[model samples]
Each structure stands twice: as structure tokens, then as C-alpha cells.
Target: MSQEIRGHPQALIDAEKGTLDPLPGSLSHSKDVKPPPSDVLLSSKEKDALVTTTTQEVILSAKPTASSVPKSKRVVSRWTLWNLWFNTYRKFFTFTFGLNMIGLVLAASGHFPYGVKYSGTIVVANFNFAILMRNEVFGRFLYLFVNTCFAKWPPLWFRLGCTSVLQHLGGIHSGCALSGVIWLLFKVVNNFRKLNVTHDAVLVMGVITNLTVMISALSAFPWVRNTHHNVFERHHRFVGWLGLICTWVFVILGDTYDPVTRSWNLSGVDLIHHQDFWFTMGMTIFIALPWFFVREVPIDIELPSPKVAIIRFKRGMQQGLLGRISRSSIMEYHAFGIVSEGRHAKYHYMIAGVQGDFTRGLVQNPPKTIWTRELKFAGVSNTSTLYKRGIRICTGTGIGAALSTCLQSPDWYLIWIGSEQEKTFGPTISRLIHDNIEPERLTLWDSKARGGRPDTMKLLKEAYHYWDAEVVFITSNYIGNSEIMQGCKEAGIPCFGTLWDF
Candidate 1:
């Protein structure tokens, strides 16, 4: 069930390793001393000392000081506002919902006779699209198509737009899901209006299905999903399953029963010909697709510190793919970024930085086998190939999401800012960073060693120019993501950061 990923150009490992080529006007800083051999494991104290020294070297080598970097006046252009709106998750949600609302208004006003058949069509179609947007297989195909077709050849704006496509697709999923519920409500209400015509079973199914769908939708609201994730997870999933079952029953009963003739047609061909029946089939397939790839796989968990568990899985994956794992096959699945040296590597990894119940459990008692989707989904970083060169910046466990891009692509530079680089993430991550990434194209800033957070904006601005990067990708907590994204916007630098919408 696992999807394979192709490796990037192996020239990255060529022994010559090539010379540092800084962009014009970039600081001519001395290249970092090559990292020690992979076989040599450094102690935590030694690694911290090395990182401290390296940070100092980078600062000293750079010509521009924090104060010397020009501060741009905070100016938001009309075009900038439009571009931001165009790329946001909310925009996709609004677009999907807004389009549906127009039809809903017409249907509700009685201007259009959108009876049970028409409303049922809208409901199933919306649900179908909603499920597809979040489908792992479909999502991977989309990333592959975009990266393959547009990588490095498309204009910067076009490529940047492509990156936003996957990240905010949840908006479409959410919008369509809610729209489906609304349309179902309309269909059910219409059924009640003609109780004489509706069958007793059909009426009962309509009411129950509406309630189930509404419950599922309400459970998925931001407040419920964020504050009570377990509640949201269980209700949204279990209730959704119940809703799907009801929908199938409703489709069958509605399609087979003829109110006008007071007759029933149970023929398979007749059921196949019904539009709602086919739509329900598509909805069922889309919802059930990911589960088909589900399997229990053996895993090796490495607890570097109490805060993080580095998990190793069999086989390799491309950068920007995420896999969902759970202790049980039915519930409590959590997603973490997959880090690998690409297809040629023996295995891929997931950095389970103890964030929630499932991750904390990994550190408390690691499992021998964990339930997971064999086919992983793609994220925005998968578009790394679109840019000739870019920077992957992150903080703390955010490195889990950012590391694979730099590891997989020599065209990418890495800047991992964390409290304890080695102690927190353990040796597995540290080794991956040191062994795979060349020192000249890398920067590791340890806040614990440096005493406090570094001036991130200054560092990013410096790296953006010094590395000659076409774009900057960030994976950090909300505050850090906001600060860096805002700074980049003001500086007119193209950048993407971790999305908080989901």
C-alpha cells in the first residue's frame, strides 16, 4: 500500500562537493568547516559547543549586522492584500461556500424547484469533492503533477501559487462538507413538506441522516476541533461513518420507492441509473480510500529526550510527505512529517516530538507495531523542486517538517533554530542534518546556548540573500511563523510558513 518516492539527483553526494557560490552583493563569508565523519558521534556537550562556535562564525562572517539591515516601512499594497487573500485557506473556503450559497439562495427562494433530487445531488457532489480534497492518494497525485510540470520552469509567482494549493485545500474540504450538510437539510426539509409522498423509512432516514451530518459538521468546528481534539476526532469520524451509512440507506430507499405509483423498484440496473445512488457511491469510495492503505507496520522509536521520539519506518519517502499513525487502527491517528534521504535510503523517519496524547505515549512506552496509512499525503514543501534554490527555516520540533526538504534537495539550504539541537531531538536528527547537509548551506542556531532567541528576521534576510534563494519556507510555532512571515512581507521577500488553519 505504501507509495514510492523517486530520489533527487545523486550529484549531492559527489565527493568534490563543489565550491560555495554566493549571489551578487551577498556576503563573501568563509565556508563552514566540514562536519565530522558520520561514524563519529559527538556528545551533547560537544555538539552544543560546536553549535555555539558555529553560530558565532556565521555572525562574524556576515558583513551586515542586525542594526545595519534596512528596516522597511510597513506598507501593505492593494496587490499584496489581493495576493494574500487569493492564497489563504479562508479564501478557498469562502470561494466554495460563496458559490454554493448562490445556488442555495435560489433554491430556498423557490425560484428554482430544487426538490429532493436536485438537493440530494448537490449534497452528494459537495461531500464527494470535500473528501477528495483531503484524500491521501489524490493529494499525492496533485503534488506530483504540480512539481513535475512546473518545477523550476514556471515563473516564481506561479510556483509560489502552486505551493499554496495543497496547504489550504482543507478550506475546500471544510466548505464543501458544510455545504453538503446544508443541502441535505434542504432535501430533508423538502421531504417533510411532502409527507404524504415520502415513505416512512425514507422520512426516518432523512431525519436521522440530517442529524448525524449536522453533528459531524458541528464537531469539526474550529473551537471544538482545537480545544477538544479527541471529542472532535471521535465524533467527527464515528458520526460521519454513521452519516454515510444512513446516506446509503436513504439513497436506496428514496431511489427504489415510487411515491406517485406507490410501487417499489428493486432492480440493480434501476438503482445504478439513479444520480444520487452514483454520487453516494463516489462519496463512499472517497471516504473509504485512505483506510484501504491502512496497515500495521513495525517501527523503531528513539527517545532522544522526554520531549521527542524519532520514529524509523521501513522504506523511504520523498520530502514534504506526511504519514498518519495511531496505536489503534480505528481512532486517535496523528500526522507527523516524514524525513528521509529519499528513495535510495533504507528507511524514512517521523519525528514524533511529544505534543499530544499519542506522541507522549511513544516516549512513555514505545510500540513494536503502529497503525499507519501506507500511502502518505503531500504538503507544501513537496514543491521544493519548483524553486532552483530555497531556504528551509524552522524552530524546535518544526525541524521535523523542514529537514526532509534540505536532506532531499541539494538546491535547498537549511536553517534550524531550536533550544537544544542535539539534546532535544536526539542523535538521529542531528546525524541526518550533519551528514546529509553540507556545512556551507546550513545554519543551526541553538537558543539555549545563545541565551535567548536570535533575531530571526535579520538571520532570514541575511540567508535569503547569501544563499541566493528564490523563496523561503518556514516551519515554526504560531508566533514565530507570524513574525517571520510579516517581516518577509514587509521586506518584499517571497516566503511561506506553517499554516495554522487546520
Candidate 2:
């Protein structure tokens, strides 16, 4: 049993000094929705019964008081978020766009020359709506239905395997946006070439719309976004608004151009009937929906340390839900997971690690009120509904994202690795864990107390075996999260973690 995990060597060395207690006879079960008290450390005697039915060899902990934990065997890992497994949405859009291109070629041959100039813009706008403006009323309701419907039906492992791809929605947004830009480019060319001499009203609008679309698309490039987040947000928001407005001007002029009459027709219902008009309308609503819920809610801020800010909101978010709150409604919005008992819980809290401008402001100034978008839809943890049991792995501030799931359900196990979490995150979080979580199910590895980081992979492997977990969710930084996620994948275990595609 030899497994290789990032920084595992150091971690294993540190873990050698730690201890796991022996099993007590007869593990008891709790009936209350609330988790049993911290005293509920399940006995090690149930190890044989707890390990999953997977083919992987299960090694129970040795009986010695200070026995070294067994090493885990490694399996080859596969990429679930790339190529065929991941980006299926992107592929679908690409294939559709490709078909459109072939159709354009056929139309060029005068076989299907229907709705050339007007249709292309509509298609572009429609694709943009599919991704950019996803939070519309009907759209959100439909998603909620799908998310809820799937949760109660599919077998846990099977659903866990499938819902693991939930984060790929961003890829569709990326694909369709690029395709829309390309299609709009062609539409602009057609509009310019067929510039009605008698009614050249759309010529300037076409040029401006094409340029704006291109800027919006290019500014959203992954590298550009990663390097300059502010630029990405500004262009994606401001230029997107400008482009959307130009799209209205571009489309109306193109639609009104009567090819035979060679003149513009100003009509009411006809314009409304056009596909681009409805698509743009829907997109606008989706873009505006989040802002509608924007309110400056009272926030109680507690700084446990300079490294961490435990910010609690008076109005609780959905349990096991993650949300975004900003210093200003329009800017500096960052996504963080919420920790609350449930709907009945008095207040929910978000952990703001001193990362950037927004977080740094909250830590230093401790705002009395903060702006939040209250859309109680499926978050990353909503996918957790797919599994009957799983392990949540997080490091430092990542614990904020992982803790809520463990708190909400008895089946989930939490492995939180950080330096002095009790001191860093303060009594609020510590007491929450101590009060609600069973001690056996929660692993808090204090790097300072342990001399160094514990063997994360080993701890994960042991937890997976100990708890009969079907899947693993990681919420650490890029390197740590990916490393453990990849390790789980290689070990023939289904895994889910943060995907930074957005």
C-alpha cells in the first residue's frame, strides 16, 4: 500500500506521531435531524462493516495503541473536467456552430439562402442568452426542478458520478459566447456589404455591434481574466451592456431592411415577434435578476486573526449553500460558502480570507452592512445530494466551503487542515463544529500542534475506508485541491472539487 500525494512525504512524517483511538463496543445511531454531540465518536469495531463495496483493498487500523497508519495504493487518475467527460456543453455548442457554418456554406450556394443577415444575429444573441443570462425566472425554476428531481431518484454513486460534471456550465457559456461572436462577425459583414444605399441606417450600428461583441469575447479570455480580474469584470459587465444595447440597434436595422422595397419599416408587434428581440429581452432580465435581490444587509464581523475574518449575516442563507457578497452591489463580488444549521437556524456565516480588495476591506474596516445577492439555488454543495456518504477535504479558508455540508448531513465526513483553526477561525466556528458534528466524523488537523501538515492522502484514504464514503469533495487552494482530487481519481474513487473555469 504505497500512495503518492503532493507533500505526502512531509505529511506522513508528521502524522506518525498522531493517534487514532480504538473502537468502543456497539456504535449508537441518532434519530434527530441534528447531528449527535461531539461525544459521538463511532467505534473502530465497525470498520469491516463500514468500508465500501469497491474492489479496492480495505485495511482496518491495527490494534496497537501507537500503530502507524497503513499506506494506500495508487491508481491512475483520469481527467473528468476536460475533453469528453468535461466540456460536453462546449462541445455541443461547437457542434451546433459548426453545423451553422456548413449551413452558411450551403446558403452561399443559393440552396438555403433564408434568414441570412437577420438569423445570424439572432443565433448569436440566443447563444449569449443561453450562458450569460442564465438566472432568468423560468430558467432558474427549470434548473431547480432538474436539480431536485435528480437528487431523490438516481442511485447515490451513479448520481454522484454524473452530477460531478455540474461545474461544466461555465464551459457552455464560454463556447456559446465565442460562437456568438463569430456568427455576429459574419452578420456584420453581410450587413455592411448589403448596406442599403437608400437606407444605410444599420451600417454604423453593425460595425459598432461587431466591435463590441469582439471586445466582450476577447476580454473574457481565460488568461486575460486570470491575469486581470478587474478588467474582465468591467468589460464583461460594462462592455457587455454596451454590446447588448448595440445588438438592439444592429438587429432592428437589419430586420427592418425590406430587400425588395429598399426601405426601413417602423412597426411595433412585428419587431417584438422577431427571435432576437425576445432573446435580448430574456438576456436583459437574466442579467438584471441578481441585482434585483441586491440589498445591503446588516453584517456582524469578528476578526479572530489577521488571516481570517468570520463574517456572520443576520439573514441566513440556505443550508449547504454557497453565495456571493460584495462590498458594493456592482463590484468586488466574491463567492464563498455559507455555514448554517438549516432554515431554522438564526444566522449564517461566511469566512472571508484576506485575499483581495473586497476581503481585505472587510477584515480591516469591519463593515456594519454588506451587499449580497440572495438567489437560493443549487450551489457546489447541492451536488452533494447525489451521494449517500462522502468525505469533504479542505485547507485553511477552504474549511468555510466544506463545513456546511458536514453540518447539514450526518452522512458527510469533514477533514479540515489548517493552522490553529480554533484561534484563527475563532470560537463561533469551533463551537459550531463541537456542538453539531460527531467527533469521529470530523478530523481537525492543526499544523502548529502537529509540528507540520498531516499526511492528507493517508488521512483521506483512512476516512474513505472508515466511513464507507462513495465520493470525495475537496475545497482547498488550486494546488492542494487538485492534488487531492487527482489522487482520489487515481485511486478509482469518484471525486468532485472546485473548477476555476468561471
Candidate 3:
């Protein structure tokens, strides 16, 4: 998705028709996008000219840059550790997988110290580790603490480097999950080797869980999630829950009620009895806690146009609010950024940008009741606490993600780029922004008015210096987020953006 598909289809309309309020009246058009003819301006002409999608030579040469140097060669030559990590996500997963493989190799070869006799425990431990990493409560505390601390820390670049580590926590989630699966398989094989009595229940549960985990991992593959999102969501939700249930049965059976004895054991009820059981219980609680908050609440949706749906509802306290709205709570869940007036606000809003069948359905036929989780999960911009001052850069409906953080912190600045942003999102959002936000701190870029695609990298470079911004918060498409992040990294400026690696 173009991050803001809500406006993209509408961008081709006449510029004067777009009713963006905050632009300077004396606007001058740059090459593609126009800048406000005010103090907050685009970069110098030379800096603007230097920015291009194609190589430097392509813009200078009469022919394509590929004519002078093949596109493949040009790209490969520009590769660096900094660029590789910041520009793409594959490296993070690959690194995690590689580390897991190496650890397993070392363990099997007698170089690793952890005992093989407790392989089953190791599996449970890894599973617990994965669960903890993905837990919303744990994630909130961990991210907020680190971000707040880094915010106060004097070493700007060092704290930024530390903050960057936060983005890759998903690595631990992936590595531990994969490792748990492998350890689980080994555990199953060992169980089979020692089996003499009827372990039909244990074997069945083990096999089911193993297959479930493998399928869950495969379904989470980036390509699968992007291409067949519905399938990905179904498998992850249904298969994941099934895997946990089977795991519960397997762990209880394997640890307490041995098939050899086939007798009820009182020790199974002991809270402190076995480490595996406790870990399993912990994982189970982590899985169940969110469902406790799941309720189908009444929704008030405003479909301003065919492209966007402004969903309003009175949720619980808006603190750290981020929700998933789905037609069916169990079938497909999509995360949306929560926008409220403030912490004391009685209600919040969720902007559903038309991206898929579910979102399209939401716009075409608004639902009376939508599923939502009570506990507000953490978002990328939740780390805004880490910066002394920052700029929230967003595109399209992406403004939803950054809007709350900026409102909550007056020190922050917001620059939103979209085509007909004000009209497409409707008056409620515009009224909220106008009433609360000072005109000086907000910049609304109407792309239809401004010629075409925006050079956000240059815009970010200028904003960082102009606003005396210590950090930048970006909530846009992967490309926009990555490009701005990459620009920040290259300039030695601390920045945070959503990797969406999950």
C-alpha cells in the first residue's frame, strides 16, 4: 500500500479543489512537490537537485543511469552495513536464523554448556522467551523505560544507537520461536526413542504442536503476509492458538502424568513443582490476558469517501491506546493507531485507510460492532519519550500513528504530506488539529497542489536542522519510513520508524 492510499487515487484532481488550510498563500512549486512559501521550506536548489530515485549519473546523463552502469552493478556497489540494515528487513531475520543455527551446531558438538538432558525444558524456555518478547505489557514497559532513559541521556548518538537496538527485538522473537520449534522436534524424537507404553496422547499432541509451529512460522513469512494476508492472519491466529493448546496438553502429560504410570499425580497441581509447567503456565497466561479484554464494542464510522473510514468509539482510558479492529475478532485483525484529544479525552479515533478487503468492506458498508482489544499495545512512536525535541513525519493516513504522540508532547513537530488530506479525512480530524495544534508546529503538504511525489528525505534533512530536532518519528509506508530513517542514520541524527517486521 502507498501508506496513504486514501489520498493517492484522489491526487490527480485539480490542486485548487484540495482545501488544505495551513499552506502559505505565496507557494512556489519545486520539481515535483511544492513547499509552503514560508519559513518552513524545502531544501536549497542544489540539495533538492541532488535528490533522485535513480543514480546521480541518470539525472545527469541523456540516457538512463543503466546505460552508463548496469542497475544491478550500481546498487551492489552502494551496499554497506549501515545501508543494508537500515534500508531492508531481511537481514534482521536472516541474522537471527543464522545465530540460532550456529548455537544449535555448537550445542550438538559438545561446545555449548547447556545440558541436553533438559532439552524439553530448553524448548519450553525458548517458547516462553518468544512469548515474553511479543507480550504487549512487557513490550510497553521495556520500550517506554529504555526510551525515557535514552531521552535523558546526554550522549545523543549513543542513546540513538541504543534506541536503534529496540527495533530489532523482533529478532529475538523470531530466533527464539525458530529455536523452540527445532528443540521441540528434538524433544519429540527423544520421547519416541524412550516410548514403550501407550503415549498416543503425548505423541499426538507433540506432532500437532510441532506442525502448528512450523506452519505458523511459514505463514508469517513477509511474502506470504503481504500476498495472502487473509491466509496469513487465519493461520497465525487459529493455528497459533491450536499450537498453544496442544503444547499445554503435551507439557502436562510429558512432565507430570507419565504414560508409563498412567496415573493421576497430585504434584501436577503444585504451583512450584516443575519449571516447565510454570513456564507453560506463564506462556498460557500471556496468550489469554489479551482475550480477557476483547469485546465487540459499538462503533460510529464515518465514510467520508470511498477511500477512508473515520471510526470513532468511546474506548477505555486512552493512555498508550492502540487497537485492532476486525469484522470477526478471531478471523482477521489489523492494527490501527489510536488518535485521541489527550489522556483525559472521553473518546479516540481510528483511521481505517483502504488497503485490503477488510478495510474496503469497512468503508463500503460500515459495521455497527467491531472487535477491539482492551489493552493498548505499544507503537513505534511510543518511543517519542526518548527525544528532547523531534519531528513526526507522516504520509497519507499515516498521520493517525503520529498524531497522538505529537499532541501529547508540545515539544514535537508534525509534518503531514498527503493529497487532499484535510478533505479526505473530514472535519473531525481537521477540527482536532486546528483547535489543539499551534499553526507554527504543524505543516500539511497537499501533494495534489504540490506537483507530484514528495522528496521526504530532503524535507526531513531540512526539518531536523530547522526545528533543532534531536530525533525524527516517521509513520509512513516501509519505503518512506526506511528512506527517512536511512537519511537520519547517514546524517548521524537519531530517528525511529516502524520496521513492520512482524
Candidate 4:
């Protein structure tokens, strides 16, 4: 007699005698099994059981097939062309405004003398200067400016443009060129005892050269504004030496000649031209005295290998009206070589002298304990569990400090947060990422990308969930530090931050 199977079709067979696995042909036969005509079909509950079983089997079979499929290709999002145009417009507006201020100052000072006829001329000139400031938009405006100003002399423009480009190449090149010219002039005057170069002439030349150097150095301010402070300082030092050379050339040439006699006589300036000679002699001696008196003394200090030693006075107590006779001297030291390798390390020392009686000399100090604490925290090892690892979130300048800490510990995961057009942390981020840091390990939370700071918090929570972050390190300069820390506390996570003591 034939019998109908109930529940799961596979369950109807005897466990000891029957095989759970289906034969190849039997598997195809199950798919062929169908309900009878509607009037004679099984009850609703029985139909429901059969449908559920078939669905489960289909899903289980599809799982293996889906697992073998490759991941979808990722598409990079590109900024719209209009966004680039808007940035160009904003930069143009800023440049034009600055030039307008300069034009107004010149016109008020009678340099431009603005009238109805000159009104259009003034606007045109201001606009041209603004265009010249932007490299991408400068070529046409620069050509027009040169053509108009020099009476359409193409050669003059060529020379001026080339000189301008070279001058902007770097401060070191400009400084060296200026100093070399002045030094050559000084040597020529000293060697030629027959021709007399007047002291006033030398002084005027020195002043003009110094002023030119100063203006050139100041012109770089706009470009250097976006650069690192260390780069600016290096440029300043180069320009400063040029100024000192100009001063030296004037003093040497002026003191060696006799103005009254109209001849070069290097008899100590006292025998031939007494008064004028003594004046020049005194000035030159005064300028050279500091070189002799000021000396760099080395001090033992425990810190980084390339640390700078700064000796600052305790305010009030110097020669000049600026109340800062402070004399500074830098002593640079070079290490022998690197351990196991041949590389060498270098160190610099800067010492300043306060011209006062009965004062004690201070030595270089050690690094603060807080610095050590931060470094230690940054060196924490990575872990599989989020609770055991630390998360670093930063904004503004704190990004650099945080990134430096992050790079030292590669095993740990990092969550970096930033704001729109806020590049204060860009240097740190770029450095870490360029070193091959994992993308999955980093979650960049941008405020602008998420609407605002409130939205940033929501996204931060989502990132935390994605990364299973335990410790949160915030590096923002904004005043909402307390709010962020509170949120982390509420989520049962500990937070560390810069700009806030907590």
C-alpha cells in the first residue's frame, strides 16, 4: 500500500536504514513534484510547510553561489566643474580687494591723483595687479601691464618678467646675489687707493640696497603664508645676512677713504681726515664689536636630537629704546654617526645674552612630563577587540601632534576627523596615509561632508560602530570639546583630547 509523507519529506524515512543525502536524479524529481488541481490540493497549512522548505533550500544553495561572486567595482566621486570655478572666483575677489586697498592708499597719498578721467585708469590698474597675483590667470594681465607701462617695449618686458620670476625662485638666491654685489664693491674700493668713494655715497648705496632686499623679502609674505614656519624662518635668515653685508660694505668703504682730500687714504682714517674719519671708524667698530663679544656656549640637555636651544631674556633690560640689547649666538653641533650604520645626526644651539650686571646664565631645559605622557599613549599596541584599542580624532593644528603619535604605533587603528576647507591637520594626515596606512583602519569624519558639527557627531557614532572603536582621541580647537567628551562618556567609551585638560 502507498503512504503519504508528512512534515519534512526527508524526515519520513527511517534514520538507521535511509540516507539523509538525496540522489542526483531524486533531487530533480523533487522539483517536478507539484500541487494537484486547486479543488483537490492539500490544505493551506500543508501548502505553507512545503513552500517554506523549498525556499530554505533555494536560499542555502544561493549562499555558495553568491560567495564565489567578486565584489562590485568602486567609483571615485569627482568634484563638479562649477565647484572649481567658484573657488577661482573667491580667490579673485580676495586679490582684487587687497589691490583696491593699495590703490586707495596710493591715490590718497597723491601717488595716483584720482580724478574723473583717472577713475577708470585706477580701476584698471587695480584689477591688473589682482590678476597678476594669481599664477594661473597672470599671463595675459602681466603682458598687458608690461606693454602699457613700458610704452610697448617688448625687450623691457622680457627682462622685467625674467627678473621677477628669478627673484621669486627663493630668498636664498636673491640674498646671495645682493650680498655678493655689495662685497665685490667693498673689495674694489679697498684695492683702488687712487679713486675715492665718498662716505655719504657709500651710505646712500648701502641704504638703497638694504631697502631693496627688505622689500623683496616682504613680497614673499603672501606665498609663504601657506608654508611651514620653519621654511619662513630659513628664508628670513638668508635675507638678514644680505642686510648685514650691505651694512658691512658701507662701513668698510666709508672708513677707508678721505672725503675732504677726494682720495683713498687708508691711514687709520685718523691721520688724514680726523673728524669724518673718526666718525666712520667709530661706526664700523660698533658694528663689528658684537661679533667679538658674543660667543656661543654649549650646554648639556636631554631632548630630541635635533632640538633648538632658545635663550630668552626676562623682559626689560637692554641698550636700544626697544629695551632689548639681547645678543644671540647659535652653536651648531654634529653627531659622529648613527649606531650600526654610518648616518650622522645634527643638533643646533642658540644662546642669547642679556646686557645687564649681576645676572645668572640659564641652560637648556629637559622635555616636559606631559610630552612624555602623550608619546606613551600614542605607542599603545593594537588589538582585535575595539575595547583594547585607541581611536585618534583630530581637527586644526592638533592633527599634526596626533598623527605623529599615530604613525609610531602602526598596529593600532585610527579614526581621523576634520572640517571642510580646514587644512590645519592636512600635513599630518597626508604624511600618515602616504606611509601606507590601511584605509579600512582609518575613518575620516568630515563636518562639511555631513552638514555640520551635530551631523559630524552622528557620523562619528556610525564610524565607531563600523570600527568598533573603544578610545576616542579628539584634536579639535573648537569650544564643543565638552559636548564631544560627554557623548563618548554616554556611549561607555573613554575619550582623550588636546585643547582640553579633561
The best candidate in terms of lDDT: 1
**Regions more than 4 Å wrong, model 3:** 1-103, 110-114, 147-150, 195-201, 257-272, 315-321, 500-502
Worst 10 residues of 4 by lDDT: 1-10
Q: How accurate is candidate 4 locally (lDDT)?
A: 0.31
RMSD of each: 9.5, 9.6, 9.4, 29.1
Say which prediction, candidate 1 or candidate 3, comes out ahead on lDDT: 1
Candidate 1 lowest-lDDT run of ten: 1-10
Question: TM-score of the candidate numbered 4?
Answer: 0.25
Question: Taking the tens digit of each residue's C-alpha lDDT, what string does model 1 give over 1-502?
Answer: 0011001101111100111111011111235564443234444345435532342123312333445333544455666656654566788888998989888888888777764347888888888888777777788888988888998987899988888766677778778888888888888888999989888899999999999888888876656655676776788788888888998999899889999987898998988987888888887887787888889999999887787788999998888877778899988667777889998799999876665787789999999999998987777788899998898887776777788999988778787766656776776776777667766567776554544456677777767766668899887765667667777887888988766534
Looking at model 2, the pairs that clash are 23-44
Candidate 3 pairs with clashing backbones? none
Quote the lDDT for 362 in model 1: 94
| Per-residue alpha-carbon lDDT of candidate 3 for residues 1-502, written as tens digits (9 for 90 to 100) | 0011010101111100111222221111113332243344433343334333311000111111222321221122244335646432335546755776776677667786563556767777777777776676776688777866667555777766555565556666666777788888877876677677636777778788789777876776666666786776677667877787787777777776555577546473652577777788777777776667778899899876677788998842332346776787666667777888776787788877776788898887888998877766766566667666778877777767778876777667777777766567877777667666554456666555555444556556656665567888776666556556666666776666665544
lDDT of each: 0.72, 0.60, 0.62, 0.31
**Residue 346 alpha-carbon offset, candidate 3, angstroms:** 3.0
Q: Between prediction 2 and prediction 3, which has the larger TM-score?
A: 2
Candidate 4, residue 208: CA error in Å?
A: 52
lDDT of 2 by residue, 58-80 (tens): 11221212223224433434553
